[model samples]
Target: MISTSPRATSVAGEPDAMSAREVLDLARSQQAAEDAAAARKLEAAARWADLHPPQSRHHAASFTLDGIEHEEAIAGDGCPTVAEFCIAELGTVLGISTTAAKRLIGHALELRHRLPRLWAAVHAGCVPAWRARLVAEATIHATPALTPASVAWIDAQVTPFAAKVGPAQLDRLVAEAIARQHPAEPVDPDDPHPACPDGRHVTIDADQVGFGGTTSVAAQLDLADALDLDHALQTGAAELKALGSTESLGARRAMALGHLARRQLALDLASATRLAADTDLAGQPTSLPAARALEFHLHFSAGLAGGLEIDHLGRMDEGQRLMVLDLVKSWCGDSHTKITVKPVIDLNTELTAPGYQPTGRQREQIALRDRTCVFPWCSQPARRCDLDHTVPFDHHAACDDPAQPGATTTSNLGALCRRHHRLKTHGRWQVSQPASGVFRWTSPHGHTYRRDSTGTTRVDSDPDPPAPPNRSSRAA
Candidate 1:
């Protein structure tokens, strides 16, 4: 009898008992099979596109499911009929976003029409699907304008190295192919380096702010200006290290950048400090006189005062926290700063009242607790978000009665960016807050996800309990 157990077969050295090399080969074969299967699925999606051609630049379709009618409109000169249909149908079938589905369809069309050689390699499982998609994307811009002969030539050049090259190397190869095909096209200049630009031109943008009080900054500058900024940051970081600062070099550099900007702007630190000191805890202007009318509040946890480690909503590390404290000290100068302790309100408690709007303190507390937009995978910081009520406020209107209004409390409120807020209000996406700061997000496709301070966790995975809030070493 053929032994079913691997150990028993291995001891007898049965023909089916493979060596390590043979097992590895079998695994590789299985992986290739899976890749080929995925390629076939993509091809099938592409074929569906061909079969269902859009009748007009603008089209409307309606379907009924479970006695409910659903209608969708597709309008835009640039949107192909095949693309619209595939994105809608395939997105539902695959349990993915329409954006993702559109990308898959785009890759499929690019492979089938633009790069036949790459498609062949993908279909044969010689090239992984991701790499195939990358090649298709890289070549797409050039392929549109090029002649069939030129596209074929570029395809031949790139196909042989598709499986062998990494993303960066493949990008280089694609650039070379484009250059060879379009010899007259102007090449982009190299990115800003340490050398200063000849002219003064600087543009700064805050690309994104995440849950942890972390901000991503994007900048474009003249070469000389870039170099000068880099040098200043390095110098300041070095100076900080010399002055008994234990922060990492990266943390010091970030602090240096902030300091350099402040110095350049000639911030009136003393005037600002005086204004802040005169302001009440509620941020109301006090009767005390101030050097300047403008005041700034540095919102931070009291734990940092006692030198305790706290990750700012997963945004800052110990080094960053230390640098922030040091920056605050520099701002304070020689003045004696008073630290006040306040009673901590239980977030889980319902603090709602008659009105729909939450109090300023409630807003601040909610923003601090839920660091980002409560939408799953959304990293927009709470400060930049809209405070949305999970349940519609009852205003004795047609839709709701005043007797049972949704309370304007922390448990009923969650932060959502304007776009997502509209989505929740209008789109089929349903959201509920079973507890304070914890949100359950249900997508249009019926997938449910839980979101909180840390990030998103799918409900199907038996997610762990929400992590306890990291408390400050010193009681507030």
Candidate 2:
């Protein structure tokens, strides 16, 4: 049974209580509700936008002089320019941030003025509101704005497939629209268009930083350029081998790329002689004047069977971890990289500090314990999250009686992202930390969720309701 305690939100019943058909129907109903909720949220934001039109007499609303231009371009022509500060007010009510609220308002305005067909479809319930919003968001925030005609075309193309279209498909459609919307130039009907295409490009996979603390690099270069690069890398690798380097060809090639980036590659035999002189018999540099000190936060593992986690570089197994570390050492020796071994924090111990702020060590302890924000569905890193007191901190009592020491302990505190922290503070969401790193969250809609290190799960009211698996069995 789910708790009816003050902290727990009262939920209806369990999903396991229902038959397969009933469960299927429940899924359909919930999807409908979700669609309606997204619609209402957009409409609410639109209403707020309408209410807060840019006042003629209003003074500078921007925080800085540099932000004025951006503030002016917040909305398009015919879309009501919303008052700047009002966005934050709406965000507080919606349990989102000002930036999110701004985006929502912009999308709504884009739908209303720029993409009317999509707007009509959204209100008619012909399309899911979020799908329509995604189209609007793409148009509203494109690198260079799409024309009204282009937006209309996009709306027409996407309206039919809105029910099942994915982001990639939508992005392609949007890109096509943007490409068709050309720059200002008088049309020359007789202009010759060549079919020539040069798709040469270099791309570093910045989005997916690898688990072994390395970035994947790909390049499509001109034939001559590729050959020259290959030759330089080969020469560098040969020179390193001549200087008694023991790294594999691929590894040395990667190191050569780094050397190229730093312009430390030996171009000729004379340069190679100078490079050799700089290196000692151990194949290590005597002194690296421009060597950079790097910091790597490695979480120690008791056994090789378990993976080791390095901050920014997910988790890696023993062999992979060792290989990556060796690469790191090659880049900068032990003397160049600072690896401080601090005492392991006692996770079970409830650490505390005075006043509202946690100590640096205490913060680190919480970051290690939670790993992410304790809010349901939020995976923001704890290092970037606010450590919130589950219960409201009573400043008078806390300061007056040192004996009580209420909410400052690890048992009472948990990591909450800024958005969720505001939600708990300003919005009606309630949270409780029953143990260190374990958070129980109650939504404004009366849904209860438990969030721990493993992730969030719903707290159902009933585990085994008095019902059989099938209606036929129950009838029998």
| lDDT score, candidate 2 | 0.66
**Local accuracy of candidate 1 as per-residue lDDT tens digits, 99-195:** 5666777777777777789889898878888888887666655533666566677779999998998989988998898778876544447745444
What local distance difference test score does each model get? 0.64, 0.66
Error of 1 at 118 (Å): 2.9
Residue pairs whose backbone atoms clash in candidate 1:
194-227, 196-223, 196-224, 197-223, 197-224, 212-315
TM-score of each: 0.57, 0.55
TM-score between model 1 and native: 0.57
Clashes of 1: 6
- Worst ten in a row by lDDT for model 1: 67-76
Where does model 1 exceed 4 Å of error? 1-20, 30-117, 139-156, 180-220, 226-258, 264-345, 353-359, 394-401, 404-407, 441-445, 450-476
- In candidate 1, position 169 carries an lDDT of 93
lDDT of 2 by residue, 1-476 (tens): 66544343335543334455775898999988888888888888888788867656457454544223223245555566865655655654555545677888888888888888888888887788888877887777665666677677777877777766687887777666666664445556686864344789999864354655677899999999999999988888888787788999987788788777755653322233456667778987565444334444444333334675433322332112323444554545522334445667766667877777788778877776676777766656677889888877777674546565455777777888876676567656677665566677665556666677666666646322221111110000
RMSD of every prediction: 10.0, 13.0
